[model samples]
Target: MSDEKSKLLQMVRDGKISVEEGAELLDAMDEPGTKPSGAEKELKDRFLRVHVDSAEAKVNVNIPLSLLKVASRLGNMIAGLIPGEARREMAGRGLDLSKIDFEELMNLINQGLEDGKLVDVDIEDPVKGRIRVEIYVE
Candidate 1:
C-alpha cells in the first residue's frame, strides 16, 4: 500500500469521494503512462491471430460490399413480397442482415439459401442478433 493509494482509499471510505470518483481518479493517474510502448509494437509485429475450426474444413469465399447491399435490398423486397402475416412476423422481429459480419455466418446462410435448405432469411442489428432478412420458397 503506497501512501497515496492508502490516502485515496481512506478518502473514499470517509465519504469524501464516491467509489466511482475514486475509480476515475485512479484512471486519471494512468493517463501519463498511456503512450504505446515500443516493445508492444514489436510483439504485435511478431504475432498475429487467426481463428479456425476443426469440424468444418475452411472454404475461401469473397463477399463484396455490393453483395451486402444486394442482400439488404433483397430482404426489403421480400418484406414487401410476402403476405401480411409474414410481413407482420418480419416486422415484429425487425430482421436486418447487415449486422452479421462473421464471414462464416454469411457463408452458412448464403449457402443454405442457395441449397434450398433455408426457405427464409431474417436480418437484424448485429449486437442483439436482430432480424434483417426473411427468405421464402414458392
Candidate 2:
C-alpha cells in the first residue's frame, strides 16, 4: 500500500476522519498528473522494452519511442547492433523493424493507448526463443 493510502486508512481507523471522507481523500490521491511513489513509480512512462531469454541466449532492449523520430538520422546504426538472426526471427513473427514507419506507428499506439495498453506480445518460438514485448503510454 502507498504511504498516502496508508495514512488515509489510519486516519479512518483513529477516528480522525469519517470513512466517507477517507474514501474521498483516497479517490483524490489517484487524480491524474499526481506524482507517484513506491509501486506507482513502476507504472510511470518508460522506454518500450523487449525481453528475450532462453537456455542458449538472452536479449534485452529498451527503446525510447522519441528516438524513433530521429531514427532516420541514425540510419542503420541501431539496426546494425542487432544480430541478423534475431532480426530474421522478429520478421518471421510479422514484426519487420526495417519496414515500420515509427512516426505513424507511434501515432497509432497513442490512439490505442487512450483506452489502455497498446500492445503486449509474448511468444515462445521453438526454433528461435522466448520473447516478451510490451508497449504502453506513460
Candidate 3:
C-alpha cells in the first residue's frame, strides 16, 4: 500500500477521519473532480449486469453506468432486443418495458444505488427447464 493510503487508513481507524471523509480523500487523490458521499466511483465506474441462464442457453450482459446517460435510447434498444415470446411473457406478467421510465430509473440509481441485485426472476418453462434472470449493479 502507498504510504498516503496507509496514513489515511490509520486516520480513519483512529477516529481522526470519518469513513466518508477518508473515502473522499481517497477519491480526491484518484480523481481530481469526482462527486462525493459515495457516489463518485459508482457514477463513473459501476456497471449494471444482467445474467440469463436456462437449460438451453446462458447469456450475460454488462452495461456501464456511464452509458446509462443515454438511457432513453438504450432502453429502446434493450426493449427491442427481447424475443417476441419473452416480450409477451413479460407483458402478461405486467412488466411492459415500454412503460418503464429508464431515464428516471437511471437517475435514481445515479443518486445512490450501490452494488446489489435489482431483479431476480425464475421461470419454469415446460421445455427450457428452470430459467433464471438476474439483474444487478456492480
The order of the candidates by lDDT, greatest first, is 3, 2, 1
- lDDT for 21 (candidate 2): 57
Give the higher-TM-score candidate: 1 or 3: 3
lDDT of 1 by residue, 5-109 (tens): 455567467654458756765554356653224532222212111111112221111112212222232233223333344345544666433333333534443
User: How do all models score by TM-score?
Assistant: 0.23, 0.39, 0.56
Residue 6, candidate 3: how far off, in angstroms? 31
Residue pairs clashing in model 2 are 45-138
TM-score of 2: 0.39
User: Candidate 2 at residue 26, lDDT?
Assistant: 62
Give lDDT tens digits, candidate 3, residues 17-127. Answer: 458756765665466432233553445567667676766556565555654443334454455545445556767777765566756777678667568987766777776
> Which candidate do you rate higher for lDDT, 1 or 3?
3
Who is ahead in TM-score, 1 or 2? 2
Clashes per candidate, residues 3 or more apart or on different chains? 21, 1, 0
Q: 42-109 in candidate 2: lDDT tens per residue?
A: 33344444444444445444443433333232224334334455556666667655555756755564
Top-lDDT candidate index = 3
| Candidate models: Cα lDDT each | 0.35, 0.49, 0.60
